[model samples]
Target: MIMCREATKLMSLKLDRPLTRREQLQLRLHTLMCSACRRCESQFELLHGLGDKLPDTDDTSSRS
Candidate 1:
């Protein structure tokens, strides 16, 4: 089983950029055995994508 720390680190790395082949293999192995971590990873990926799709607002006039 992948420890929480390692899973968290992998999660962060995934958010930063595409994983190397070794990293991808490791993540796959970890997820295959750890359903909880897999779910967490999926949630993080969904939330990250959602954040990216959100529009940025610089104008404050609407609030006035």
Candidate 2:
């Protein structure tokens, strides 16, 4: 069984890249048994989606 720490790490990495089949399976299993991790995963997805829709504001070139 995957620990909450490792599961959380996988959840964050999922935002940046795709997980392997084994990784996906492990995370799925952990979330299935752990409600807290399940909720954390949902929050991570929501935050990541919000980030994608926001416009980039780091325009240093616009400054003098």
Question: Model 1: how far is 44 from its true place, Å?
Answer: 0.6
| Reference-based TM-score of each model | 0.76, 0.89
What lDDT is reached at residue 7 by model 1? 75
Tens digit per residue, CA lDDT, model 1, 1-64: 4576787698889899998888878888888888888899999999999999999877886686
TM-score (C-alpha) between model 1 and the true structure: 0.76
- As for candidate 1, its clashing pairs are none
Which RMSD values do the candidates have, in order?
2.7, 1.6
* TM-score, cand. 2: 0.89
Clashes of 2: 0
The lDDT per prediction is: 0.85, 0.97
